[model samples]
Target: MSRAVLVEAPRPTIAAPAAAEETPAQRPSRRWRRAVSPVVLVVAWEAAARTGLLPAEKLPAPADVVAAGWRLTQEGTLGVHLADSVTRAAIGMLIGGVLALALGAAAGLLRLGDDLVDPPVQMARMLPHLGLVPLLIIWVGIGEELKITLVALGAFFPIYFNTYAGIRDIDERLVEAARTCGLGAAARLRHVILPGALPSIFLGLRLAIGAAWLSLVVGEQVNAQTGIGFLMMEARDFSQTDVVLLGLLIYALLGLASDLGLRIVERRVLTWRRGLRAT
Candidate 1:
């Protein structure tokens, strides 16, 4: 008996549009790949407890987390925690963002000003935000003010550094051209330099927002009556890893939401710069 061998030859490269048409069909396959592991993990987890591979007390199923979150929501505890976290993040981000933008603008405008302010700000940025928590607790007494302050400090440097970099990197050629138009230094900065720098500034803002969220968690975890971080800390004391994971998941979603909202605002404000494609 003779056996037939199956062989395949590679297809030649297709044109752009022809290659692109396959993308939509492959998208579902891509999505399936992304989802397969999580689905498998959930199934395995459920099976593990049923098969005595994992004890119910030690490892709860994803269903338990859903139920736990639902119970917390029904009792209004989750809402309160989420609200506290959101409020802290919002207040801190606004304060930090405003300060960074103003100071960065100032430093960018004047070399003497940058010399006076930029060095120390850069130095401070090198220090971790969480490393400052103990000092903050000692100085500010672990209240709402402390929490907000921690988050503000956490957010400030990213925005300031990026904004300053953007400003400093503004093309001298553009400045010279603007100067030829009878544009004053202030006018050049406000109209030309700042506008040119907006994209970098927004990138910094996105980064600072992420920093703010992280610092908020640390602030709440260390000392607080409320917020998702506090809930997770308390859950840890009770060995409720599921609750801890749930809190973490919620905070991740909140950060994602905040970043998405910021992106929307950024796009609207920076629409003019889109043509430049500096990104």
Candidate 2:
């Protein structure tokens, strides 16, 4: 007891933390999966075309379509047609989107505005806008104006409805919280409403772009002298199936490209969205 040693307990060894396994990112795998289905479809299509099960006049092989597209590209016809179609769509979308934003904001924020604007819009939406093409042509003539107007009409309602819905759908609690914090109307709208509505707006944007393309398809097909639809029609008259398919492929590609662009924009704009976070 007298010789009690004040020996310190042996210091515990602290083990080093293990390094995290360097797992590869799944991005490349996801991209590979997306490519797989389309590649398989293309292979099957080429194989079927070689089988002669369907006449070549009806469905051209993918290779033939690519060849025809290349030929058109070399001739500079494809560029001109693509440019015209894109210009019409862009102009129409801009006009329609501006109108929609104004109308949607008014209707969504004010009951009187909603009563005055929403019902008529809903009624008009029930009616087929494409059927109005004949009348549109009669009034506007078969020109650039006709195509642009048709695209505008096609794009308008989707934007209007979606924007209105987005605004109306904002959580009431969030609005109350903003009010409790003494936020001014402009501040509340800027910080709360607009952000809340953006996802819906992007959804509408995608749909509207598709609709614009669809309307352009119909408009261009009717008494059109230029654009991809006209090119397809011209090819049809000569039974140039490859060229016709190429035109269709171009339309599909354009629509896909536009949607991809919007998706990129949405991802950038919605970076704060928690659901986008991965574990």
Candidate 3:
């Protein structure tokens, strides 16, 4: 009996490797790396333009575009156009954002609301919103209303869809837990739902900002008296390629700046989330 007795040892557990920490010294290098591609592209473009490989008549060099922007700045027209564009965008965003939050919350939180609101919204979103320009022109005429309406329409869907999706995507268990904890509906919405939905909301916000700018560009082109789009149109009539290119560059920079700002806000708001990072 003793000779037949045997024993087994426990297996050793292995721990996962920790993520590599990024030092302060690495941050500047990382930022520099990000700038490399844009720098190279600009250099290549400038070289091509100088060599006549890229016709200046078609696409102006970066330096020429810079000069055009400087000239516009000196003329005082640039500041006025910039201010007008910002005001239009801000007004439209306010209108669109309010509507989106209301509709999206209703549709997301209430079964009856979803049944009533979702179908029309889904159908409407299927149509290219920008394609409504002609109809909008007739309905609102070529004025501030036309431009603001177009921007509002463009900004609406992204925020609405994202907000709806974000609220719906929240865990049922979390809602149940909140209920079990005897939290009121308002409290649950404020603490549990909105916080949980913020990531998607911010994503929508970023997208909406971009859509606002794009809509502004088109709206301003509808016999606009001022704005970057109008400036570009004026330049086109005069065959000023450099000014047109500068307008395009300004648009790109504005969009990029907006997206970056949103990203910073998102990171701050979602500090609890430990998302995967690109190496």
Candidate 4:
């Protein structure tokens, strides 16, 4: 008879279940909690105002803001000011966005170019856009050019740096594989590098978009322009807090709308990345 030995293999540890029991709808309820949480806050605000918890002059309820906004819209004042702000922001963002894409793509492709321009880029970025108001007014004579230039500058740097970082950080092995597969420089860039760097570019654009809006508002306040910023300033001079608040609310809503659009674009462009696993 031969003696046989039995060996035991180690059992793999079972990980916690990753798929939550919550349905997709339930998963998104968390977002609503945050979204509608503001409703609760607004209610509390109205209650406090009515109950004399706060001076009515110091704080206006949502109802008052709504009424004020409605009044301004009916009067056509808000529409005119809001259009001015929107136009400046849109034009500046378009110009800066194109330039940033071109510059960032160049910097990403050429290390020498990045080194050459990066220092000046950093210097320009360090100077606050608002701080340049006086200089722009002097150089551009307080015209539309001043405001547009300010917004363009603010919107440029974020996209540039993010794009450069994106291309520089691509997986080395992937590039080597492209080289091994006989991909030319242009083909490798077009096929792999640009696509891989897209997420970073979008991230930069989101930041740039916000900056563009802010810079436009600040620039609008500087000169005799029609804009939300001008509306706010004008309302402030007259102690019309409701109009000022309305202008602010418009800005917030517009920013949200633009960001939502960008998110939609991102979803389409990055469909391959959604819920996908990395190696």
Ranking by TM-score: 3, 4, 2, 1
Instruction: Provide the lDDT at 63 for model 2.
Output: 86
Residues forming the 10-long window of minimal summed lDDT in candidate 2: 270-279
For candidate 1, the TM-score is 0.79
- Between the candidate structures 1 and 2, which one is better when assessed by TM-score? 2
Candidate 2 at 96: error in angstroms? Answer: 1.1
Ranking by lDDT, best first?
3, 2, 1, 4
Best by lDDT: 3
Candidate 1, lDDT over the whole model: 0.87
Clashing pairs in 4: none
Quote each prediction's TM-score: 0.79, 0.89, 0.96, 0.91
Off by more than 4 A, model 1: 1-59, 272-279
Clashing pairs in 3: none
Candidate 4 residues lying further than 4 Å off, grouped into runs, are 9-16, 19-24, 27-31, 275-279
- Candidate 1, residue 147: CA error in Å? 1.1
Per-residue lDDT for 135-222 in model 3, tens only? 9888989999998998898889999999999999999999999999999999999999999999888888999999999999999999
Each model's C-alpha lDDT?
0.87, 0.90, 0.92, 0.83
